[model samples]
Target: MNSTRFTPADAAELYGIHNWSSGYFRVSDKGEVEVTPGPGLNAVLPDIVDEIVARGESLPVILRFPQVLAGRVRQLNEAFRTAMREYDYQGRYQGVFPIKVNQRRMVVETIASAGYEYAHGLEAGSKAELALCLAQNLHPDALLCCNGFKDDGFIKLALWGRSLGKNVVITLEKFSELERVLKVARQLGIRPAIGVRFKLNARGSGQWEESGGDQAKFGLNAGELLQVVERLRQEDMLDALVMLHTHIGSQITDIRRIKVAVREATQVYSDLVDEGAQVKYLNVGGGLGVDYDGSKTTFYASANYTLAEYAADVVYTVQEVCKSNEVRQPTIVSESGRALTAHHAVLVVPVIDVTGPTRGLQSIPEAAEDQHQIVKDLEEILANINTRNYREMYNDAVGDKETLHNLFNLGYLTLRDRARGEALFNAILQKLAKLVAGLAYVPDELEDLPKVLADKYICNFSLFQSLPDNWAIQALFPVTPLDRLDERPTRQGTLVDITCDSDGKIEKFIDLRDVKATLPLHDPGTRPYYLGIFLMGAYQDVLGSAHNLFGKVNEAHVTARPGGKHLVELFVRGQKARRLIESMGYEEDMLRGSIRAQVDRARAAGRLDDTQTVELEEDYGEELLGYTYLEYEE
Candidate 1:
């Protein structure tokens, strides 16, 4: 029996649990599969992968555990509920799934269904998103918030939602949007709740710092807020203005910054109520972050506070502010999309190849007549080097290379001499750089040279299709080999995606202090090596493009029961090549006909015999009916 005790760091390394644990995931002794604590992922993963393979799926698959999603929703609601009860706060805490984080059907549906008990809702930013939210969210009491820039069409959708008896809040990002909302509501004969987004001067900390402050793109200014109030009063719609909203940004790492924003936004809520605008809810838009590095430090992609601490801070701050201002404590609503959704999905891909620069050269060899002088000179420098004159000797050796290069170019030395001199010089530099690295005084240029010299692992996934944020925004996702945690990794390599473009490489990685150029992975072998891209459940799916015509990967939804039996359910296979072609504006039948015509032409040209042509045609026809990309095998 294999016995390996994995820490949270190991779980983060294996399953991509960067933040506090929400899902019930555990690794068994042998590490063959990471299972939910009950039935074990060992029983779950093989069944899931086998079912997918039986259906003829390929590598680079995304295994989504809906049980994890359900667990996250329950934890989020429980944290707030526990805080509310413990603090004796007067108002309720309700959470909405920000559809922007992940707009997939299974994810949204699972969150909606699991959160039905807590009245958990969905927040939509666009018309299409609104349609999705309305269709999936069957929770009658859950709030459906319509945010972002609104046009007449968007406002109409919000009003339409209100007519369906759903708790639809149209949050006005700008003063002009208020009139659109009022017009649409009047036309549709539905009184939709109104919320004004406040542009607070307070700023947040982390990658999404631009989400708040006076320079934020969304939200109404002081002047605009007052105008909106006057317009609501004149139109006899002040009663509909029931919610006040503000957002600091996403991935907030500083707890102090969140406290500051909550205080400011709470003051804004108090002022709205004091000015005769009915404000019953405070919507602190999503800023809760995940601790990507698991350090609990203030990094760009992480947070410093625990979920309970964050809830306590928000509730306690709001209660104090409202009490001091002589206003009723408003119900707290949070759209903490990333924190709730970033951990439920994991992308698994295989390492196909590894490459690096050449190695294994000491001093330049003393060859025949031509290269002997260069070798002799190199040996003399190595022998004469002393502690006091080592630096000067190294500099002098560098200058000799330039002189040797000129001599070779002018035909004064043979190519053999030049090669020997170059080899000798590089070997010396490598040794010096290693010594410098050991002394911890490596220059910036030399710091990444070791990684650059290491191999590049060609992974069987597309950066454009699987991890667009890493490619477009230079975002770093935690990547670690799945089954090799017990053994220490020895190879350092960059990850190259399966894209035809040169830019499809993942060289930037998340380190302890900052981003790095390469990751340390295991050496390749006969069996397949797989790496899981962590914390990608939030935004990678819907934002992914079919760049290079690579469509989505196969998806599996696993659920862990209480008794330890894992259930593996295939959600959807990825887009077929024919389906991808149809999506790109080509008719499937037309594409098939064109392929058949080419095969016939090849046969007619005598390039293929009768049997070969028949086999070729059959293969092409089967591929047209099959899924995109070929299956990856060892």
Candidate 2:
């Protein structure tokens, strides 16, 4: 391999860290990733990892930057404010961070505290989330939006918010929720503020496009909407309607679809105002996309427009529609959860081991004289392989490999010969790969050889526990090495999580032009190597499931103080084996007793000594408190 030199700026541009990180992370001059917690301050990521290790924390920990969260909130609000001022719109812009994006207490609390300037609020989709929001000491005027199907308990909690003088708006997703809201409000002798989620005819563009339009699972139809208005008027509660909400979907890449939905939602708001319902807020619900791949295209993983452009389109469309109808412009509210939180947290995992077909074999061994004929054929193919006839040699190698396997199964070829044949086949493939590396266009038959030659990096993390989105929906997150930015990577590999399941691997990676089949990485020496998966603070945390009994990982909330100082505001340890089993409804004491009984039985049978018994019991007890992940010394 040639010696290639790289700069901090080169690494930044290569991974598009600047595009999505929003100035919070960059490659430093020390050839390590630097965290810009505050303006003109920097902290290296390797140093942070060292600090975390010093505290006895394990690998696969989440590093959160609260300043990045605050910066996003500021960017969203400031963009809308700038757009409203540019368009001369009278209504103000207020946005809420939906708790579903990242329901962790630290994440939600950080957003709430940082968003105080913008009067930023919280959006809850479930009862527990609603109760959480109610418990937070949010700004008095901060809007609390309740969505989804509400039970009696959920509605009462929302009503309780109203009684406490908070700006609580219960958005009716289904028609039945309205009756529950009304009945609960009547029981409490409080008039609750209400919002209606409209099922718009315009469909968004992306993975969640089906979340909107007439066929959506949520929201009321035109006839149902009219019935709601008529019933509210009959009950003398028309004035309670204060917000009109519609969500086209999340991660909307196209700007035109947003403009269309905004226009449609504003028309509904204006018509409701004309009907004397007194709706004061026009809420175009969350669809703000993040540029995950930094391609700025209409791809499923990228956003076609910038946040400022999104705000401008939303502000201009609403203003134009209201002006055309001669109705007063209502206050704009956006529930952009993903955009606010995707950049706040990063999942850092270490590459523990590297495995590949060529991992052990250094050179092809000379074929034994008494070797099987098929093994000899494979060796000949490897020996005769050259640039002119690599394709033919590859075909011969494949045919001989299959035949050797068949012979071994039929008791014809010995295990020794089979191993030699397998090694020779792989070695030939590696040689052919090098020959084809410089080709302008590889042949179709050899196109997949490079992928087969790709190394498998065994990382210390659970795919199902940490990054379920990548496993479930194939979502692409930015992945790059945290250090060694000045040297070029000499190997290509795919990340394999430390799970027993074969599906727990990340094969697709983000590239500037298109999706890459493999990620370039360095050889893992005696020291530990770390890679970070960026922009995972959105739905990954809450949506993750306890697959393979791997629970939540350790989390550290990092605060970049002035004078380039770093502080860990919060540290949450990962789940232990006993806790993980208990979470699955298995009693820890009962399991321990069962294991202890087996050990005592062995001791009684003279299979153990006192020292062995004590050691066994101590090991068992220690295993209970040990981390679920594999622990190692760095």
lDDT of 1: 0.77
- Over all chains combined, what TM-score does candidate 1 have? 0.86
lDDT of 2 at 616: 91
Model 1 per-residue lDDT tens digits across residues 221-304: 888988988898998888889888899888889999999999999998998888899988899888888876665788776578
Position 407, candidate 2: lDDT: 85
Q: After superposition, how far is residue 489 of candidate 1 from its true place, in Å?
A: 1.3
Give the TM-scores of the predictions, in the order they appear.
0.86, 0.97
lDDT of 2 by residue, 457-537 (tens): 999999999999999999999998999877777788999998899999999998879888888888878878999999999
Q: What is residue 339's positional error in candidate 1, in angstroms?
A: 0.9
- Candidate 1 regions exceeding 4 Å error are 1-28, 31-56, 358-445, 561-565, 623-627
| Worst-scoring 10-residue span by lDDT in model 2 | 358-367
